[model samples]
Target: MARPTMEDVAARAGVSRALVSLVMRGSPKVSAARRAAVLTAAAELGYSPHAMARSLASRTSHVLGVMVSDLHNPFWAEVVDGLDGHARAAGFELVINTGGRSPARERRALRSLTSFRPAGIALLGPVVPSPAITAAADIPLVLISRSSRLSTVDTVNDDGRAGSALAVDHLVALGHRHIVHIDGGTGSQAAPRRTGYRLAMARYGLAPRVVHGEYTEAAGAAAIRALRRPFTAVIAANDLNAVGVLSALAEAGLRVPADVSVVGYDNTWLAALRHIGLTTIDQPRAEMGRLAASALISRVRGERTKPVRHLLRPTLVTRATTGPPPAPDPMP
Candidate 1:
């Protein structure tokens, strides 16, 4: 069957095409009664306005492009929820794509979003190079879980360094001295988190052991397999990596919190599962999304010029994963 159009809605509502057009555009000139009639008629016919056509007509886009770094991670989903809610409330829609954590794919995803001529774009945990991001400056841009010095772009991020420090301090207070860190290699904000762990370890006069890892369960598992030194606790780059570490430790016949304790970053829903109960850092994923949307929309509306850098605080949520280090092994 042919798709319903504005003319069909106008005819069904017993109104002129121009009136239907006015109603569709949300023109204040239309009476409430006529608006109701048009809406009802359009609903009956399953008629909806073409957003692209409307955008072209007004030379203004009501769509916001969002590039997600990883689709498998639940963290990004929470952020998108916050972003979508705020964008919808502000009369805009979201077009989301993922780069699968690949920098090359991210560059392609960025280009795809730009082709739509959206009002603005939001990049969540993008790994794309600086130049690629800067090239997109023609459109209002917001970065989440990433940083930018461009005076034209905005950023929303949790204090990664502080988050890592919190985890380290919590474990140290529990009498854990030989704690190892599985760092998020090349991931957004990974540097600060790694630095924080090193700095905190130095502050406590303890040696810091870092294992190179990506923000993945596999990476966490691999890091554990690669460990050569004795340690009582581990700080993973993120919750996903922590879970992997848990699995690997179990396979190695080690009981969590009994033989070794673990901590993770990004307290995503996965971390809160009853079976998981990860001790992790809370990054306020939803709030980050909302702030990113607000920043981009504000820029789209020409409300601000100076870059808005939203650096939110992170907190530690203790769960089942962490405990005092096991008593020193009896001398052989």
Candidate 2:
């Protein structure tokens, strides 16, 4: 079957091609009744404008490109929801792709997004090198859950240091002197959280034990199994990692918050599940997404040339996973 075109809509709506083009572009010059008639005719005829061709013709795009580091992580999904809503409300559409947390893959993804010649781009938890990010800044760019020294790009991040401190403080308040942190190895924003954990432990006159791990459930379980000694509490890298810790502890016959309390970061949907009920740090994922999109849009509209960095504070969501330390000899 032949594809419908603007001419078909114009013919059906009893309007000229120029009027139909103006209506498609949402120009205010068209009367409300004419605009409505053209839109209805277009819809009935399944006629829609070609995004790429239109962008090329006008040297403007209504599309925004987004690159996410990990699609498997629910946190990014929640953030994307907020970004999508705000972008759509602002008359922009989103095209998203993921790198699966690989630097090489992320570089390729960034290039692909740039190839589309979008009005702006947003990178969520990207692990690509700084040079790659800086090179991609020919268009408006925003980074979420990451940081950069590049002056051309904007960034939106939750205070990872404060988040880790909250987890440590919660453990300390529960009378837990022996606490361990499962570090997010090479993950974006990992260093600050690790530093915060160490600082908090030192402040409370407690030794800090950190096990290197990735931001995944498998890494969390492996880190737990690799621990030399049993700690009263464990702070996993994130909610997915916390789930892995729970599984490992169960296998070892250690009950959470009874033998060892567990805390996670990035209070994703998985953390709020009744079965999981994880105590974790809330990174305001949705708000960060909104802010990122807004900043990118501002740049796309030529509103600002200076970079804008939005740093949001994280909060702790206490759930069933955290509790008072168990008696030293409770197993006996």
Point to the candidate with the largest TM-score: 1
lDDT of 2 at 317: 98
Clashes in model 2: which pairs?
none
List model 2 lDDT by residue over 91-168, tens digit each: 988989998899999999999988888999999999998889988888889999899878889999988888999999
After superposition, the stretches of candidate 2 with alpha carbons farther than 4 Å from their true spots are 1-3, 14-18, 29-36, 330-332
Q: lDDT by residue for model 1 over 99-154, one digit each (tens)?
A: 99999999999999998889999999999999999999989999999999999999
Q: Model-by-model lDDT, in order?
A: 0.94, 0.92
Worst 10 residues of 2 by lDDT: 50-59
CA displacement after TM-score superposition, residue 202 of candidate 1 (Å): 0.7
Sequence-dependent TM-score of model 1: 0.96
